[model samples]
Target: MVGGGALVRKPASPVGPLALLHRPVPEPPSSLRRGPLREGAWRSPLRSERTATLLGMWVGVAFAVCFATGLLSHLIQNPPSWFGWPSRPVNLYRVTQGLHVISGFAAIPLLLAKLWTVYPKLFEWPPVRSLLHAIGRLSLLVLVGSAIFQLVTGVLNVARWYVVMPFFFTTAHYWTAWIAIGAILVHVGSKLAIIRIGLSEPAAAEPPAAAVAGGLTRRSFLTAVAATSGVVALTTAGQTVPALSGITVFGQRDPRLGLQGLPVNKSAASAGVLETAVDPTHRITLDGPRPQQLSLAVLRSLPQHTVRLPITCVEGWSATADWTGIRMADLLDMMGLPEDAEVTVESLQESGLYRASVLAPPHSRDPLTLLALRLNGADLHIDHGYPARLIAPNRPGVLQTKWVSRVRAL
Candidate 1:
């Protein structure tokens, strides 16, 4: 009142329901505000929100591609009633499985870069600001944990190194993918506004710092990260892309280095069917309307047809070979079974998850589906399912069922 202003009022205090949200954050004690929690701990210009956001976008895309392809592989291996896969295109599974593995490898470098760019946030003062903040941080733990687990397990699987994992890789990897994807969705939704701003705003160059020397700029850091990812993908993709096979440093199997000039995921000896596969008394049983147990000689005596088919493995390596065998459809016709009948192929393996595989009508009746007895020309290599094996178009190598012992109509 003493000044020129008349009837001046102080700002009204926040009085609504969400007033607590408007209150100032409490300051921490001196003892609690040391080390990374100190005000000047983070000063790197390269750790800007823009850099993190850009890397996160690439990480998100890679994870999405990896998850979609992985889910398709799982469904194909264990299809429900609603699912039905086609028998044409021959290389469908190969392409999908290869993409699944390659995208996963690409994500490794992108994720690491994103995490490094955002590392300063991990040490933010007064870590738990609200209930939502605590939940969000917890979700990040799950996200990072699951993402790391997936990449590690996937690399191990690709290398065929199963001894280190306590649980089955397929089952654990499949379930954890769901958790990782959910956490990523929640994180993305919560940061949508910040993400928009980070992407829209220009990345300004940081002023020169006397303390830090030779640190990477934001653009250069991003470029390096992208180049690393590209190198990883190009080197690993050779497992599926034949043209790049010569430079495949990380591929588990060579497309041209196994029995019969085709890669083999599991050999007859490893399957414990080595003796049984070549036993003179071995008989391939076909159970149907006209059940018959035919010996290897009789199987050879029956009508023979040759087809060039690729043995595509889930491990992302494939090789084409000339397979000679009895047509599955022709065998069904001779056994008085319907053309569309489904069947279960049982292998001579004493015990294994892939010892048996179920074939739906599409594959069972496909013209290229064969009870193969020979590969390339001569009798099948012992490791290539000597007596007889199931060879079908557009099917995973695991489901090709080596050392066939029986085919039962379902």
Candidate 2:
């Protein structure tokens, strides 16, 4: 039998490794049809291709729903700060936006199954198939690829807040997702024929091989991957679920947040940022065209604005903060920071590797731009980017740039 554990196979050709390797893996002989046929819901008798096709299509539908919802949620939560969607109550954006993550997770098994059924047609290549057929097959592959990326980065985002290893999901995840979605659309449009095939066919035409592998087919590998995605979600869920709120495992929670877990600096003491002294001498800075620079005194003295904004992470976790920093725009205004100005931020602790920042002019001008020195109200914690850190409403947590030491606008 082959490594995959299948039926018999023909002998290998003479000469090389194939000849020496007595059928490293054996597949069932072409004549063998070992398993009893399966009956799908759409089959005339629930055993045909119709049933399988229908089931696969429905799974596809579930994936489609998740994709659309998740994308909208992303746009909303990470909107241009001044961004708006439809004429609906803009207040519901966060709630509606949550659907992107939750539902995206739920689509795992469905999308996998949908692909499993259609993928067989994909290898019918080298035959110069119709343009649409080729496009459709390519699309499905890309969708699967994209879905994988989304899950990976989404998981990483959670790891960041959870303080798990291999941090950096905030930046990496955002970039990959854009590529994934384009692939999704191509796969979806090509499936119109498959949907019709499901609706019109009789039973018995379905394929049993199409059943997703585990949980009696109720929960496939896709489900396992995404369902387990909740590890990060669970880490963050302390705030949402009372039962889970206080329980601590290896201390992932922030004692201050009161429940929902917050990421810790793991090396707060070693993080090396001195927050003990809000020394006026330790001035804030904003460097400008021709390297013009100013002290925090100068920044605060220029013009100040305060905003109550939350830093939401892609890991499906969030934290609200009252940020009090100079309006990025006002500071930039001091040096005439360009609309395309790129800024670099530094922390007091020469220890942190972070250093560059970008200021989206007129954009950062919003009242939400804050250089918070406090959290919830009090001075910022040593672990939470103390002394001061840049917080922006227009960006994901990654872009906020903690541990400020310098700001270079170029």
Candidate 3:
């Protein structure tokens, strides 16, 4: 008997051979026969394989998008020898990182629905039917655990609530993403047949378990879940999509609210560089074959060029502004560095994970890359990296390296 004392008919086995050798099946342990394991503990007709399968498909797709975009982001920040990120299509990082965050948010509802639909399975009796079944269940645990971790950490990171997280957000999130995606693939491969059956048209005589009179029909439930996902995406996407800013109740940053018509993730005060940035003795040292120290006055006097660029943050907000500064190529030329030289840009901020960033040859030589001195036709705001800051196309906001101190060829 299964749930609700319903008699479960068993298929007859061949009895002509080896009948006497077949041993009687053992009874399940007391631990497996109580609470949720009780015969009628879960009676919800809505918890069907079909509904679970549908929700699972959508969750998988959302995770796929997040994985792709997130991996791209990690690689760009920590590029390998063969990986070369493009410098063109200035808004490329903006769009991709935005989609990464939006998709992660959208997955929350779908993931919850999927878990609700299949939650009863977590209490299945005879949990380890075989070695293969044990392996499958283990994968499910990894899938659910890592998926939850990714979403929770992602949301916290966006909210800038790092105190609650015990581990380093970026490193933990990046590595666990691999585990989540791998488990998802294993789960999908194991459930291929069931997925196909669930997605297909129902048979004429199929039971109407999900058609409970007072509760939500399966179609209605699915529609509600999808609508919730859509709502989440729309509300939070204003961080990246300027058109929806008015309705963005949960966005981390307002594109229109910040220093010089742009959002500031890290201010000069927060970075502990306020006094250092304003000090008259400050000079950006360029260390290469021909070392030179250029003060703020010298940086401004050296032929200034203005180019429009967007600063895209990993948290998903982006803002574009006209940056006036000396081109990176020009700076490199002044240092007597070759065209393909790699450089490390340092900040005046005393300490932080991103106080310094290495600029690869492509970005170092790119004409659009600048050691910015002004924003929106005025001198750089103290919070927006006064004196000088690096502004490069298709680069993350963190890598912009505020409060110019030194640039060294690597």
Candidate 4:
């Protein structure tokens, strides 16, 4: 009688709803019968090798992103704003400049790993020795050399460091980077055949012939990837997380940090004539024949001004430092130089781009700008123009002259 009653009531114990809720949803029947998934459903297994090659080219692609953003940054930073560059009516250089530096910095380990993986292939002999070999060798050399130079300079720039070399890395860095692009183009363009051969038939693609010959395998490659990523993560955490900075197991030469510093001139006198004297006797001659040395102490004693200015470089990089020094306008006032007269900042370093002197316009008199003597709440490093340097808001680092001994107001 109970069973008959349950059937009559359609089993209304909520069991059916609960069963419906708990049951797994079935996958929709694929249109692909036994052959393959629909066009988008399943990519051919052959594409795996192609995928690897493309992944391997990621470093080169990163370099391209850096160069484009960096060059774009330079034009925007310019006073006149040439080449249809974005006008900084709202200071857009901040975004692009950051992209440039971040992109440049991130490329460090990517490039290293990519190079390590592909370098072995360079020794592979051509089936037929000819121009391809010569071209490939030359392209590899240019790519590797350019990449090293670019990344080294890039990482140091992020650290707010400089050497007694080129101040206008924007012009020189951009110029060389463009050359790098050309080299990369040749590298890619020349290797299209080989890349195509490997990638065209991903299904047919097996272990890279060279890698197999060298006893490398996908498993080994994966292990290397895991190791590289771990190191990078540790490196990143140490930098961003102050807590981890204490447990720096790695030495000072952080792989992620790249080279520790820029080239500095030890012979260049670190002691400036300005630092040696006191306030009363010190006189700053500006817009005059020469800078009348004034007591920077006196300038400090008057009113302490602080502008946290970030020096952005055209090479797609930037660094922030607390700028503390006499205002360019005040210096002009002290020197009795005309407000309109242009003051040229000459670095101890030679020009890497042009033959003639690079000049910062008279607009440097802006109150926000100052001759910086300190960085990050401390004394400037010798590697970073020890005694004095120029700090301007949003100007490329090259324009921020280092090892600045002479500020002639002409």
Candidate 5:
């Protein structure tokens, strides 16, 4: 019996819902609990402000090299009215483009390490403490995203994986680089004071807990990152530096292997110019003040000049060969065109976008610019532009029109 204020007892059945409800509630696991945000949790013993700052410095240097070299390559491919690239140092384009690729590759690991070092900051509470802070974070996101995009697309281009890209790799990569560099500049400017402090401070010793765990130390981690970058450079630099060819397991092209001991980016068959390129009746039509149609035999009979020049591709592989052909200046002279006249070189590869390229006045006037008939003292390989090709100094290999059919002076 129970009174008005008294509780009534029920038979305890372990399988029943009432019995189960009476059982004590289990506590949550320690890992599932949310502890207060603390410095110790946010900062890894292996990573510190000093470590991040040092990594940032190295990353900055790599970016600087990449930017300068990339700009030079772009200029070589697309010269302005005032810019006159030199032709004497035949390997100038090769060196600059090589540096651009290698520096870009080296930046990968450094960027990853730097990101890891500061990753905890991404989860910082009160994320937008101020307008400036919010802007800084946004800028960082853009910089990181652009940097990754540029690096990935660049690598894909080097590997000749055109299927992966939705747009033209060159145009996308070029514009993205500008955005990435601009974000980097803004970030550095905003964080100048903090960066100075971090860099000036001496590296902290490993915490006791970290030492007891016996994992990678901060110094060891940095060494590993740097070693990774060096390994990447060694494996890819062989495409440009012949000495490293043996160890270049990852190189896209072998400098010593191709139609005439040089790598070929595009073949006659792929370019759809094989028929016309090998046709004996194919003649080069020069359209200028005095329009002229000259057969290959007749063009070959003209004054031939031999020039040793390196063909540097946008992908960064380059090879030097003795090209025998008529000087473009001589051709212009025969046409009675002015010395400052610009010329348009058209290729028999009719379907491609780069089938035609324009030579500025300086390039047209340069004696190194040739309508090449032979390479390396041998008849040009069908794959290497059999009938004729344009070999110009300090120009990207893509701009070197192959299977030449016409040259018009402007």
Candidate 6:
């Protein structure tokens, strides 16, 4: 009634609540609308199912290598009752631990590339479309999280940077590996179908216009990723592989740079055993049926035998040097003990988890086991356990028990 136009609109139709709810809403602009699905809809030019599958295959190989080597290292450190790790080929631990670290480093680039290829799927609509899909997605999340954690922590450990971790790195890394491996197994099983399809598809056609204009093809991108992994391995493999030592600027230790052509992880001063290790009053007490306490002079005068063995550390560095000392078997015999007798070697370090270590019958009886007093024809370096150290085949450098104070038969 007030205005002709306003009166006409009310008369045309009484807009009730039901009508208002059912009214046609104006469409948002195309920029704000969800677009129709199309092949290769991901914005990233590098995103492709085939590319992800290829990268995944390489990553799987790297994981397998890392897992096998890591398991061997764990077993070596904490052998079960039934396991018997070999003591020969003295560089066995060096090679395995080196492979473990190098493979892990190499996998970094592959993992990142693989994630980048499939990252778009992370934002897919309706994340939990089905029960199995939900399980798979959850497992993928675990796999990614654990893999990143393990790699980061392992690298930090290699650098001897313990300040970053709140827990023991070795134990936590070992357990998390099992979890990550289990998730990987499940993810592999779940995605077998997709993986096969992606791999079977004829190589992607010339990538989209964006990829062409950007000057990076899928093949070139994968090659770059592989090259990056290779570079990382080359830079660090020298820690174990002697051939690359001269060029491995990024290695944790230069095997030839420590006291007497070998690296020492913990110096005598750091271990707080310097005074005791170099003291003339120091004696190696042998406790057995015929107990004996021998000074350093008497130990050196005894039938000294020389064996070329490598001191391989858990940190993945090793160096072979001429070690001369009384054989453990010989010493056990002199003490009226059986050749296969189990013995505990105690260190003068006073503190640290590895201050004392037990040698299983097999290791104790190994002819290569020695109560070493000399390295490379010279008296043991102060940092190399001045008076005496234990050097045994297939034994971790830490368990070699520097500054030996006592050997007790068990």
Highest TM-score, which number? 1
Ranking by lDDT: 3, 1, 5, 6, 4, 2
lDDT of 6 by residue, 113-185 (tens): 8888877777564445544455667778799998888888888888999999999998999899888777778
Give the C-alpha miss distance for residue 397 in model 1, angstroms. Answer: 1.3
- The 10 consecutive residues of candidate 2 with the worst lDDT sum are 37-46
Q: Could you give candidate 5's per-residue lDDT for residues 330-394 as a string of tens digits?
A: 99888889978888899998787788998875678889999999999988998898889999887
Please list all clashing residue pairs in model 3, or write none if there are none: none
What does the lDDT read for residue 60 in candidate 1?
Answer: 92
Clashes of 3: 0
lDDT at position 129, candidate 6: 52
TM-score of each: 0.91, 0.55, 0.90, 0.52, 0.86, 0.87
Could you tell which candidate, 2 or 3, scores higher by lDDT?
Answer: 3
Global fold similarity of model 3 (TM-score): 0.90
Comparing 3 with 6 on lDDT, the higher-scoring candidate is 3
Best by the lDDT measure: 3
- Compared with the true structure, model 6 gives a TM-score of 0.87
lDDT of candidate 3 over 1-410, digit per residue (tens): 23586766787764644443343335568765888878668977666667888899999999999999999999999999999998888899999999999999999999999999888889887666655466668778898999999999999999899999999999999999999999899889889988896878452323375547577677778889999999999998999988988889667988888878998889888899978899999999999999999988888889889999999998889988999999999999999988889999999988999999999867888889999999999999998899899999999999999898999999
CA lDDT of each candidate? 0.86, 0.50, 0.88, 0.53, 0.83, 0.82
Tell me the tens digit of each residue's lDDT in model 2 across 273-292: 45422455666565666455
Ranking by TM-score: 1, 3, 6, 5, 2, 4
User: What does candidate 1's lDDT look like per residue over 17-82, in tens digits?
Assistant: 656645555545668888888877987868766887899899999999989988988888899989
The residue ranges of model 4 lying beyond 4 angstroms of the native Cα positions read: 1-52, 65-109, 112-138, 145-179, 193-280, 288-304, 311-326, 330-341, 346-365, 371-389, 396-406
Output the lDDT of residue 185, model 5: 86
Query: Judged by lDDT against the true structure, how good is candidate 5?
Result: 0.83
For candidate 2, what is the TM-score? 0.55
